[model samples]
Target chain A: MISRLKEKGAGDLLKCIQCGSCTSSCIVNAVNEYFNPRRIIGSIVKFNRLPDQDPWLCSSCSICVERCPQRVNPLSVIMALRMIKYENGDAPPSRVFELIEQIKKTGLAFPLSNEAYEKRRSLGLPELEMDEESLKEVKKILSEAGF
Target chain B: MSMTLYLGCLIRTLYPEVEKAVYEVLGRIGVVFEEPKGASCCAPLGLFSLSKNAWLRLNERNMRLFQSTVLTVCDDCFASLSDAFKILSEKNNVRVPEVKPFGKFMLEKLEEKGLRFSFKGLRCAVQHSCHLLRPARNVDNAENPMVVKNVLEKLGYIPVSYVSELDCCGGLVFEEKMRDAIARRKAEALEKSGADCVVTTCSHCMRQLKSVSRLPVLHLAQLSALSMGANPEEIGISEILLRRMVNP
Candidate 1:
């Protein structure tokens, strides 16, 4: 896992001195004390494995990145961890699949609703439409990415 | 130069008022823009985290539509789109357009047109999205970190200083229980600031903050639209919004 993370661009994992500043400054930690960034870093550096749900708990705001004295960029490390998980056939929550499915179908995160159409029409702004070709291309990209 | 507007999923589906307000306000300031097709979600936090390639190619495909600038109200989208572009362009040699968020982009145009408006002394708590302010390199150069605060002040409004004003709204994490707690905690701090309305730039933050706070939430475009000659009622802003919320 250490070699994989290094290859996956989380080489900053080596730079961490485990100062615990990240866990202290983390906003998520303020609410759930168990969601400690320090523990994640320590565990990942030591065992190269993340505790259950640790990486996903991060909001990816990069506050820890800005606060890290070692410039470790823990958020990127978390992201790399997530990608590693997915590559190993571990899936995220169901909503992530739903989002990709929505994008595949509508080329959007959500389906455009009637109220939106009414709002746009009422405003007299020209309707914005995604052509079929564009939708096809979007699907192609998602498919190529193995979504 | 005119901008090519990229209405991501949230703005197009949820907050058309923000869309309308931004379009009308930009028109009022003499900037030409087009609502382009072929745009999709920037795969935000969850999607990006789970699959970086999907996030990269989807955004790159979307970027294939425009050159120079793609204007948006979603800072998360701007952050994701720009980061994807930087990664793809550097690694895979793919090209992508630039993303300009609402606050800094609006301030630039207002400066160019020499258009200034006052806020009539309304006090607002500006919610800064983490994506906009952090990982700062590769951002759209929104100028100072206080771009929205400066714009509010220029429009004659006061920004209330409060603890945790710069904290994330915690919208990125997918854990439902922890997500709600984070949102509620941040909202409590914001409400305690005693600001009139919670003002923010990102549509995602507006929704998340509004769900958790009793205070009225608004996009910076909504507040500035009222000041930029768009009718408050026409753009879905209450006519009493400013007068009722002004700081004592």
Candidate 2:
């Protein structure tokens, strides 16, 4: 677990000293009693398992990281946890995979649908345009990165 | 002198009006902004947490897609592209084009144009989105962005200070459970500031602020246009915000 977390991005999470600053700054914990950052850190440190899908609930806003005294980067801890989940054959939501596919296919988040085209035209903005070379390069990078 | 506008997926997909305002205001202020067509999502949400390597590579691709200065209307894109620039330069030893938020870009250009804010008595608290000011190396003024405050002050609006003004709006999490909590904090900021409305430089913040705060929220571009005496109808700001514009 330590090796996996280190490989992802939250290697510094081992520096966590049970400080509750992350909990105090966590927007999720502020709302839900079940979502506790301190407890999750303890679980990862003491045990080898991610508590649950709780890490996926993190907003990736990095507020806790901002407020963390040790600069332990609880946000990365969450991300590392999610990466572990993905590696264990637990795929992320299909919507996320769909977005990844969209980028590879069209070099866009979503196609400039007719509604958007009309909106841009109404605003006198030009239509979406991209060079073929950039698209091919993006595909190459994603393919090489094994994304 | 000119920059390619990097309208990320959020603004293009969900908030095209904000994109419209960005173009109109930037154009009005003498900015030669062009839409970069091939730039995809600035490493779309969850991509970074999914794979940091992929996120940086994707954002680098998007950043390199445009050869000129890149201006972003979405705070997430600003952070993502800025992160790409930082990683590519510092970590990977590669250089890419400049990616700046529309607020900072406009602040510089507006100062050059010597434009003054026309409205004199409006009060607004700016929502500083997390991504706009995170990761330390993404921007020079990540600690506290003065762009929005300066624009409001020049426009004759009060830049209010409220509790947790710098807190995250929790928009990045995509968690429905935190909506009420996010709304409460926004209400606290608005109530403390005693402002007529909230303003933000990020499209995501603008959307979240609107959902949470009872007061109307303005994108800096919309506010800039309104302050410069542009018609609200043409800029595509909501009627609620248009109503709050004093002496427009």
Candidate 3:
């Protein structure tokens, strides 16, 4: 388990001292019982395995990092574990997928109609246009980026 | 010069006027924008916990759409794209294209892609997105709240101070009841801060802040637009109101 985490550059998990600082600082646990950084770390250290779905409760907010006295970045640890799950085809729900679909169908993500553009121009803003040449350039850039 | 502008889901759906304001403002500053076809969301919503492969793939695809450069006016978009770019570039051992925190990524990507465009120095306040500040370690002084101040100072904006500038607006957890109290506390503190206008990088933060405060909330792009002489009305502040009447 340590090796797996280290593979993601989070070898610093060994630095944890079972301190309850992170657990006490966690906002999620304060509101919800599902999240406890101290318990998560204990599980990782003792059993070398994280609950398959329990870690998803984290908001990924770095409050724990800011409050930790041991300088252990528990958020990164959680992220590294989540990344492993994602690679294994266990990604959680994402609003981004729907958003991407919206962008594909519409040149602009927001519904910017011709009338809206005209209104903007009437307000003295320049016209926004998209041509085939510009589209081709955009596609090329995404391809190179491995998109 | 010409660059692809990344408008994230929130701005595109909830506050599109801000997007228009960004274009109008940047245009006055001599920044030419192209609405790239086939552009997609930067996928910030699931970024922190999404599968690395999916997140990186989506972001790389999103970044690839711009020919010369990419301009992300939304702070969430900037933070999401920047994180993905950093991770993918390092994992794949490729040259990471520079992503400008303000709008310079537009110039750099365009130049790298061999697209021609010209731009002038822009003076603007860059509000740091909370996600970028809180979760991400790349930002400086998240606790004291100075990432946007530094960016604006670097880009030449007179930085302003708000008492609760560093406090969370409770955006990420707004669905939680506790968020209301947290946001109100943050809002009152920030309102007392002496900024002429509040400039933020995150659409969520912008919405959350604007919902509770009477002070004008400007996206970094909106502030940039104001500096470039775009009318504040064009950004649709009046249309953005929630219509909740406070009983005196």
Candidate 4:
């Protein structure tokens, strides 16, 4: 499991001293106690599985990444774990899938609604339509990348 | 060198007001910038969890659209594109354009022009979003980020210090209630700061704070445009505050 995590670009997972700085500084953990980075790291290192907490709750804000004294990069470890789980068919939160679907459909994570389109026009902004060819290229890249 | 404005998904779609501000302010300052012919999402954080290779590849593809420096309005877009290009350039020796956050880019331009507006004394609470100030080595004084404060001060506003100045808005958290809790906490701190409004560089932070905070949330560009004499209707901000800002 450690080797898989390392291969997934979280090679510093073993350097974690369980100092709990990640938990203390975590924005998600500050609000919701369920998504604890320190406990998740300990569980992954010890039991070779994620804890019962939802790992998808991580916001990728990188505060934990910056604050880790051991340079363990808990954020990268969480991302690596998420990638592994996703590849193994662990369903992420529905919102993530919706975001992916939106990007796949429009080449944009936040697509403009009809009202927003009109608002742009009223505001004297240029049309934001992604050209057909570029959209095709974006779709092709995502498909090639296994999305 | 000229810059290409990279309006990533968040600013281009969810917040067209930010786009207008960027456009007007850059034009007013006489900075030469144009929108790219083809662009998409910066392949934001969610994609990294799905596949790192895909994220890097999409960013590299997007990077090809701009020939020179790329000025990004969204902090996530700045971090994602720059970090991806750092790795891609190391491995492939590819030529990559410089990726700059809007605040830093504006600071440089204002410094070069030796420009300073009259102090309006409008108190602003600044949210220096995480991606723009983190990973330590990438930014100086990451712990006590002054970019937003400096930009606001140069644009003639008083940056009111707040207890939760460094707190994340939790825009990245997928859980609705948890996200609101974090944002509400930050909003409460900003509210207690006695500031007239909240100012931020990231569109996600603006969205999150605007949703939860009673204080009017302004993008740095929006504030810049307003202070530099743009009408409220032109920049899409409230006219009353605009009147106080422009005439002051």
Candidate 5:
């Protein structure tokens, strides 16, 4: 019931009837039991504490959302839950954290460490460039946005 | 115009051939690139895993470093960049990084920073990245998607309709148990659809679909490069079938 949850399109949690149709149709649960959409909804309906790690199991595939007769976007609910977990520092994996750190340091993700760039250049590909001045402009825009 | 090419993890490690093809194609289209040092994982994996704050902060740092228009040949990177821009702009109230779902981000970014570039239209099938189209809800139509098709048509490619246009390729769930079934379903849809070629934004989907389909799956950049007259072997899709349609 967090205000941000409302902003993220999670207003339909009340409309869910617990019929298990979403559970049956969810591909995530078909492979991984931890990804039960019904259980997550049950917790929300009962006002019980939402499980900390359960929401992270979602791949954001939207299969459940497509199948739900009630129009309840279970993925959005999971996303809202994840936001709470993120703020509380209960994140899922270290690789996720490492990746974010890399992006923060380098403009692109997946460090070009594998020498893929050189291989590309050997194929007669041109070297890409964005000088410091342009980067400064982008930073200026992001800074203005409170980033 | 010269720009930095951003190749994500999957392309670098799993599909270096794709990287090669994209480079050749872009070069043919008169697009030049400089690969920056130390770029790594756009953190879409983290975002997919629901690490929002981590995803946000990391992408924020990327936004800070990039001053030039960013050009990416990978749909995963493109989707991640677009989604990150949307998320950060929403939270921080700043300008959304002018990025196209395909090759537009780098071009638009250049324009924003006072550079000039012209785009010739491309004929292709736009494989929408799941995160951008499904999660971010940035795509206009969920059932019958058109963002990528519209972009290509505007750029000059005859956008062809395909059956797997809106189907999932099981990219995110590749590690899951149902991956084969999921991939099969996506492959069937794409094969049944009659696109001249399958052009996608996500590298993961490209890889997944490529594994299952006989039809050629080209990255949007490769298609652009091909249309601009890059040789097929140089584009790395010469061996792939170019049949008009897959048997249903």
Candidate 6:
């Protein structure tokens, strides 16, 4: 699991000193105590165990990334954990899935509504049209990424 | 004096007004910019959790379109593109263009002068987007970012100090109740500060703050355009905000 996390770009997570700075600065932890970065990293560093908590709860604000004295980017570790869980059949939230599907089809996560299109036209902004080639390329990348 | 503007999905889709503001402000400041044709999304943070390779590849595709410099209004897009640029440059020797966030880019341009401001005395609260300052690489003082505040100050607006100024807006949180709870907390802090309006660099922070805050929220570009005498209507400045924020 540690090796996988390193492969997923969280190589420095082992440097976590359990200083709790990450948890102290965590915005999500302030609102919800269950999402503790220190505890999560401690478990991973000590036992090489994946966190029992939902890694998606991390808002990716990266305050933890800034406050970590050991230079362990807790946000990246959390993201790495999320990728491992997701690739192993754990589903992300439905809204997240919907965003992926939207990107797959339109090459955009937030496609404009008709009202929005009218608004854009009224604003005199140029129409943002994605060419077929770009869309095909994006879809190819998404599939290759296992989305 | 010129750059390519990458309008991330949020500003391009949900809040086209911000796009207008970007155009108005950049034009007023003599910074010529063009939106890249067939530009895709910036590959949102969720994509990183799925596959970092895909995220980098997609962002690299977008990065290839811009020749010299790329300016982004959304902090998420700014962070992702900056990260991809760093990693790809180190690994594959890709020649990624410089990525500048809207606030920092505007600060640099407006500091050069020639633009005039028509509004003053409006108390504003600035939300420095987390991604722009964090992982401690994008900026030096991530703990107390003043990029947005400095830009507002340059334009004659009073950036009021407030508690929870450094708190996250929880814009990326997947849970609704938690997201709103965090936004609400920030809203209360802003309200207590007696700020007439909120100014932010990121569209995600703007969207999240607007959802819960009673005070008017404006992207830094929108506020700058209005201050520099752009037509309020054309820049999508609401009559209420214009009266409260500009005329006050």
Q: lDDT: which candidate is best?
A: 6
Q: Clashes in model 3: which pairs?
A: A138-B65, A141-B64, A142-B64, B25-B225, B68-B109, B68-B110, B69-B110, B75-B201, B162-B193
- Model 3 interface DockQ: 0.22
**Model 6 TM:** 0.96
Say which docking band candidate 4 falls in.
Answer: medium
Report the CAPRI category for model 6.
high
C-alpha lDDT (0 to 100) for residue A1 of candidate 6: 81
**What C-alpha lDDT, on a 0 to 100 scale, does residue B62 get in candidate 3?**
62
Candidate 2 chain A, run of 10 with poorest lDDT: A122-131
The C-alpha interface RMSD of every prediction is: 2.0, 2.6, 5.3, 1.4, 5.6, 1.1
TM-scores for all predictions: 0.93, 0.87, 0.67, 0.96, 0.65, 0.96
TM-score of only chain B in every candidate structure: 0.91, 0.89, 0.72, 0.95, 0.72, 0.94
Scored by CA lDDT, what does every candidate get?
Answer: 0.78, 0.73, 0.59, 0.83, 0.60, 0.84
What are the per-residue Cα lDDT tens digits for candidate 6 across B1-248? 67888879988888888888888888777777778777788877877778788888898788778876999889889888898888889988767789898888877777776444555788898887888888766553797787788888888788999998889999899989999988998899989998988888888898899999998888888888878778878777778765665453
DockQ of all candidate complexes: 0.70, 0.51, 0.22, 0.76, 0.20, 0.83
Deviation from truth (RMSD, Å), model 1: 2.5
Residue by residue across B1-248, what tens digits does model 2's lDDT show? 77787877756765666777776677676767567676777774667767788888777666655778888888788887876787788976766778788777766777877877666467888888778776564453655767678867876788988877777776665556575576567667676788877888777677676777787777777777776667677666567655665665
Per-residue lDDT of model 3, residues B1-248, tens digit only: 57666666677556657777776755655667676545555655444354355556667766666565556666667777888888888888866655555534433333454442222233222335666666545555566666565444533355665444555566655244555655566666666665445667778778777878666677766544544455657766433221211110
The segments of candidate 2 whose C-alpha lies over 4 angstroms from its true place after superposition are A104-106, A110-117, A129-147, B112-114, B138-145, B179-193, B238-243
Stretches of candidate 4 exceeding 4 Å from the true structure: B243-248
Share of reference contacts found in each model: 0.82, 0.55, 0.24, 0.77, 0.23, 0.86
Model 5 lDDT, residue B11, Cα: 73
Q: Model 5 scores what on Cα lDDT? A: 0.60
Q: Per-residue alpha-carbon lDDT of model 6 for A53-147, expressed as tens digits?
A: 89988889888887777888888889888888887889888888788899988888987888779989988888777889989988998898777
| Model 4 per-residue lDDT tens digits across residues B1-248 | 57888978877787777888888898899888778767878777777788888888888888788788988888888889889988989989978888888888888888899989888878888888888988763553688888778888898999989897888898988778888999998999999999888888888898899898998998999889877887667676886665555455
